[model samples]
Target: MMTHPSGLILPESRLSDLMREHPHTIPVFLRHHMVCVGCWMSKFDTVADAVWNYGLDMETFLRELNQSAQSIPPQGTD
Candidate 1:
């Protein structure tokens, strides 16, 4: 798992996979609503950029992302 400086813990799984399963994060993308979060490009993108690009609150966005993590089973558990 890769933890971002902003505290976003990226799973070992690819961004495409994460977004594929967590389509609900769509609302977080304020800009480029059509941009897919789980795409390969997003893998290198940081959570800070995501919020800034989407015009979101860093704290709130982090909270939401962490909350999203709770619903997902930890790696190797599935």
Candidate 2:
């Protein structure tokens, strides 16, 4: 439960939890070429785990994820 600047997402946050809570972030993961969307390990892996496995820059990944999370409207909202 590492706290990040975005407050909405953290490095230790699980992929399933993040997607369930903020589906908009799904595109961000895909954009980064992460196969976490439907991966079985997503339930157990954290964002940091995915980033490290994919050899991505932590700051850039977190920034994009946070931006997407912040920009998307709540589900069912007009």
lDDT of 2 by residue, 1-78 (tens): 433444567788877777776788899988877789989888899988998999998888888888887787534312
Tens digits of per-residue lDDT, candidate 1, 1-78, equal 344444344433344434544544445553346374545677666565565667867677666656765566434313
Instruction: Provide the global lDDT of candidate 2 against the true structure.
Output: 0.78
Error of 1 at 74 (Å): 2.2
- Each model's lDDT comes to 0.53, 0.78
TM-score, each model?
0.53, 0.81
**Residue pairs with clashing backbones, model 2:** none
Candidate 1 weakest lDDT stretch, 10 residues:
11-20
For this target, which candidate reaches the highest TM-score against the unseen true structure? 2
lDDT of 2 at 60: 88
